[model samples]
Target chain A: MARVNNWQLGREMSYWYPEERPNKQFAAVFDINKCIACQTCTLACKTTWTSGKGQEYMLWNNVETKPYGFYPLSWDLKLLEMLDGQEWSEDGGRYEGRTIFESAPAGERVLGWRPEDEDYSYPNVGEDDCAGQVDGGASIQMPHMAWFYYLARICNHCTYPACLSACPRGSIYKRPEDGIVLVDQGRCRGYQECVRGCPYKKVFYNAMTGTSEKCIGCFPKIEQGLQPQCFVNCIGKIRLAGWISKPGEERPDNPIDYLVRIKKIALPLFPQFGLEPNVYYIPPIHVPTSFTRQMFGPGVDAAIEAYKAAGAEGDDDLTGLLGLFGSTEEVLARWKRSGDTITGYNDKGEEAVSVPLREPVSIRPSYDKLYQITRVNCP
Target chain B: MKKTIPKIVLLAFAILVAYASCGGRTVSLSEVVVVPDQQITLDPTDGAWYAHPYHPAKLILQDMVEPRLLEPSTVEVEVTAMTDGKQIAFRLEWVDDSQNDLPGPQAFIDGCAIQLPTEESVSIPAPQMGEEHKAVDIAFWRADWQAIVDGRADEITSIYPNATVDHYPFDAESLKKDPDAKRRMEQRYAPARRLGNNRSGPRKVPVEDLRAEGPGTLSPAKTVSTGKGVRTEKGWSVVISRPVPGFLSKEKSSNIAFAIWQGANRETGARKMRTGWIPLVIRGAENE
Candidate 1:
């Protein structure tokens, strides 16, 4: 094992291979507060990529009602239990406890579990159940009927992917150009070790073809200077796709860096896993910090507070940049907020999208002289 | 070097057993020699099996080695050999409480493999799958692969029994109008098979010819082997047939090894019980 620096954990951790980072890492930021569990992204991914024989159960993108929902049964709960109470540095920047790689059992590469067939049976396992305040069985009052927030998930394309390291034949690899993790179909032998090693459980086994496949991060689209299908088809306009830089190399013009590094309003899911996941989420403000802190790590309080401030008209730059989420099909390589307009640029530094921060509201008079009729409700 | 002494003593004893067996005398060689016959058969139920002896090869746990299993499940594998003048076949049987012929992410299939050095030399490579510059030929058989070759559909419905599917694009009725689209969908769905990964499914045979110069170097070989496995009351009995090994020389003496995986015990790649180099005494028409 070699010591590789995991900026997420703020420490060097042991990994099977030495440190070799990609040139440009694919990253995304999901605004949980804006998601409405529409599942448009899920269907978009299914039809575009996973509409296959053995991939019938694959949901490369899924929006689960968090606090109770999980894609593969209790994926997080089981791994968290295995870690046995993770303890980070007092400031939450440095991880004090063992990571999945550190706590691996003897003769194993990574500490992981393979979900049973039944686990993938339910893509949205706990969606129907009342999540937030159903404990006391309160009356049907309109207090907070929407207790849970939707967490839209896809492959994070981590820097130190466990799947890449767990594969005995070295079939899984990380792209040197864009940092996209992929399973080489020519080399994979259906060992399912990659399936067990992925913390997010993104890798799936295909019974028909007898090899493992995973979310390619929509590389075909990524190669053509377009955003992924899931990111482009988000109905809630909650996802932004872009390239993230290494620590100490953050650029202000980059939308992903602006949200994840500059504003510190976006945090990775389970940073303690030591994968250095590229996908980031702006924590939900309504959810308890106690719960969000454990899921998103110590950055929950800061992220939630910053996100709440953006909505309260305190952070215009942050709010305006979010308006560029679903504004274009092209990946937002660079972004800028000038006056009332938010402009996003494509990889070639060409303008791809420009949207106003606040859309104009229109009203009609109660009486329509031209039509010789009076409106019923409008005034 | 002290460990070589036991191997040398075993080699000497194996030579004595071969001489005794060749003399047409009834001798119970200690799992060391197999007298050949022209009418060798692969069927475990065949009377020809009784003509040969099932030598008990004790299995050792693959533990403490880098990329090794934590525990062993199979204790021993009963082995016997035969030849049909052109090719050789080895029959292996082991006791497993359950028959695990299904393949899933969590499922492992009952399987066995035989390894023979590609070259007959004074110094043998490491028994734990040869070393660099020293290669071994492997004949691997999987019960699931056998079931597939025997007409078991390699589909999800065959394993789950109650599994349901709305529709696969490649199998959709609408795509029949567009053969190009249908072919594209089929090709897209089975990428591994399209790329010619033999270990991945849609196979025509149960046994695979594999070669490795060291651990993790295993890959498909040009030779095509064949095998069949039957579920017995106790466990499984399998026969793996391959070409006459090129290493068979006039010396009439060589080494062989065996490995077994119990699917029910979650035994698969690298997680198996194997034997060290066992003395194999052979006397074929070509060698003689």
Candidate 2:
């Protein structure tokens, strides 16, 4: 077994400090093997959150088909160009990865140095821009190798979010209580600093209000001990919301522990980019390792292997917890052992767990009931 | 061999350079024509209105007046003659109300010469003849004035300032007497008419009954407490025992005025205006 490095552990713990920071630190672990890409979660979030003017161009949560897939037309490529240095040729042509800044004449300078420079780089390819259907090659001879998968993504609410550091107006802030990063609309001048600063480009400018807005992480509902609208409405049952252990705190031996820790299927998205995104994903099962390494990072193989080993150990609790949408023996035992106190170490010192602090409670009924209460006008 | 090669290359280069320089062509600059600014003047025959294009002025009208006469009264027509051999024509029409065309006795004056060279004055007498008044609508147009009337050339805005219509009351009786006479006169004098208003007084009409009773009741009278502690025979009570003017009542104008004016008037020899001309008469003898 490869030794787990301190950088990865330290990076993970930074998210959990100052209160097991809620949605910002707590990531949603997606079992991509089970995700049918029905787009239920995407639609659910769209109707609840992004159904406002100026939000028309935004998809706070989106399930994009992979390979040739991107929401704002090559958003990843445009961002990569900004992040990686590019240089101008002697003949005044530009090529990527050549120089930090392009050489120009005294009066002329190449534009678009920062991420915000490519604000609309994500091309929202409308239906009009779609290529018409066409057949390629002989049907039998044409390779069936092109496989597309769905990736549901949102603000990772990162540990050291680039957006927070980039804001000059000091409008974007992470709550000390829950670590939820929020844009103060009153203070924001719409300089689009946060939008450019955020490597993920999650902060979107609302043209109607003339201010910046982002995911609020459903803080009001979370305060009532309820999951976020996105997680609660996830039809695939692929999203789980719970507090992570505080730094130095031993993780619980429950199903959440198995799903998040032991199985190791839940890996952080684009860890190589070093954002330490809170949202994690169970790597898509059959994609080639080379593609995964390029997309995710070098640790993809080991993470998958650890998950497989955990399953083979005849740990039904581990297996069941790792399975799709069913409570495993471990989950049941944890539920039965409720109120049984156990001592655990937090960052400061050891503390007794009077009850399972963070467990996956039934989010559907509460969400439906809350919907009914808040949506009194609904038929 | 090398020396010969260099000579051959130089000879080819010289031939290419000679062909390239000789192939270049020249372009001559076109003649620039500077057109002098045209001066347009609409001087009303009655001298009631004057409009000069060189010094444009605006007339403001309010909606309270009659809508027919509220329109623009007059516009002058002028254009600089261009030597491009192109004839110029000018036409003015009311933008809003197309049915009201400007009456005309349009004139083509030499703009270079401020005075009308041929005629001292061109009169477009009000549309109505002498007595029974009818409303007159008038505007001006100039073209190769001959071609415009002949319909040979289209009316162009560049040659004409914006079209304006002036409505004025005309004598209806005169129009009736010369039914065919009016048409003949219009045709005869149509070229010299200029459209504009002659009136210079305020045009707003005052509105009566500006305040109308709406759905709700009027505000109720406030019950003000006096400080004298007096209970009237009527159920209304006053608690004046505290102070003459309570804190809440200090802001009232009547209370503040009474306090200031209640003192004796030294200028009037202590004679109180409120006590009337004399003191109350007694029931005893008048002179005792």
Best by lDDT: 1
Docking quality (DockQ) for each candidate:
0.58, 0.01
Interface RMSD of 1: 1.7
Candidate 2 per-residue C-alpha lDDT over B1-288 given as tens digits, one digit per residue, 9 for 90 to 100: 344557779877765564335324111111111111132112112111111011111122211211111232222211111111121111111111111111111111110000010111122111111011211111111112222233322222222335222311122357767667654443221111111111101112100001101101111112221111111232111111111111111122110000000111110101111100111011111122
lDDT of each: 0.82, 0.36
Tens-digit lDDT string for candidate 1 (A1-379): 9999998888999998999989999999998888888899999989888877678777878888887899888888889989855888898879898889898888888989989988887787778466565546666543244467788899899999999988887889999989999999988877788888888888988876778899899999999999999988887888999999988899999999999999989999999888999999998877767777888999888887787788696577888898998889999999888888889999999999999877677777788899999988743
**In model 2, how large is the Cα lDDT of residue A52?**
43
Taking the tens digit of each residue's C-alpha lDDT, what string does model 2 give over A268-315?
665544445667777665555556654554556766676566556644
Candidate number achieving the greatest TM-score relative to the actual structure:
1
TM-score of chain A of each: 0.93, 0.65
Clashes of each: 0, 34
